[model samples]
Target: MASRDDALRALEDRDWSGAEVDTSPSRPAMVVQSIRLPEDLARWVEDEAARQGTNPSVVIRGLVERAARPAGRTDVVTVRRTELELALHQAVERAIEPAA
Candidate 1:
């Protein structure tokens, strides 16, 4: 992206040029770890990701998020993409709209 995109390149160059910096982060910092899943579970995750029209990482994240929430919590969680935002919403809607 830095090689092909000027805006990204400018940011990558890190010549802040007097831009204000906000050191505070609103959410937990990202942590990367690798896990090994059994073949059957792996297939299920891949299938769910395909059904949701998202990558496996997103499906896994949503599952983890739901599991981490406390029981009886009524909060709704929506998984979305910054790029192709509308497309993602439509795909998700198609999965439940008929019953909903």
Candidate 2:
């Protein structure tokens, strides 16, 4: 993984030239951890990534971020099994709609 400074500098160079850049000191680095998922869950992550035009790592990261967000945060998500099942069913409809 790239160092935080390198990532920040790359972002600054590519996007923040005219804007005020935060020259503040960097925070402590994030810890890296490995997880072993059940095969079914791993396959679901890969499938969702394919549907969303992203990679499995991105899907897993987004899940972790949402799960870790503090309570009362406006962006916190609550998912229901029924909602997820409906969404999965709808994905099949969506997949065929464009070709019709």
Candidate 3:
């Protein structure tokens, strides 16, 4: 059995008091390369980040993840222009309709 002082010294060396090792993929410290986007796209990314209440990098990461995901497994669906217009019309009609 180890002495109490030795155990205390080991605990002091470990130092697990509220400090995280930060192994998460979303943490900025994990990135090794820097990327520069075109001005227009960068502005759009910032604007979208503001609208979504998150950092621009997070928005960009989400977009990259979405693009990399397997087809037909996404939460968002792509549609034809006519189908989008029809859906928009239906949504507007529903919004204008009075509650029952």
Candidate 4:
């Protein structure tokens, strides 16, 4: 991690009082994380976000998610089992429906 400003560093040093971890994938909780970044890099992130027509938070999240999931992986997210079953049933019924 790059050197954070003293205030940001202090925040990081403090113990978190909220939930420590979220293990669920679907409907995962959002947590605010503080980090210090070099001024130039932070500017670049803001610039990229502007170019992409999105806010800085979206850009940052995209970077983190892309890095966390390596290339050639398809299993990012999926529908719930119940939803899948319902869709599959409808498709099967349509495909096998008899014609007069």
- Which lDDT tens digits does candidate 4 get at residues 6-98? 779888888798747876686668998777889998999999877655678878887898899978998858667986786687668768989
User: Would you estimate the TM-scores of all the predictions?
Assistant: 0.55, 0.45, 0.44, 0.46
Please give the RMSD to the true structure for each candidate, in Å: 6.0, 10.2, 13.2, 16.0
Candidate 2 lDDT tens digits, 24-79: 87765677678899999999999998876668887888899879988778964677
Error of 2 at 29 (Å): 5.5
lDDT of 3 by residue, 8-42 (tens): 99989985888878776863465645679899999
Arrange candidates by TM-score, highest first: which order?
1, 4, 2, 3
Candidate 3: list runs displaced more than 4 Å: 1-29, 74-100
After superposition, candidate 4 runs with Cα above 4 Å error: 1-27, 76-100
Best by TM-score: 1
Cα distance off (Å), candidate 4, residue 17: 35
Candidate 1, position 3, lDDT: 57
Q: Write the per-residue lDDT of candidate 1 for residues 1-100, one digit (tens) a residue.
A: 3455887777788967889989999777888767799999999999988876778998888789889999999975554466468676777789777873
- Of 2 and 3, which scores higher on TM-score? 2
Q: Better model by lDDT, 2 or 3?
A: 2
Task: In candidate 2, list every pair of residues with a backbone clash.
Answer: none
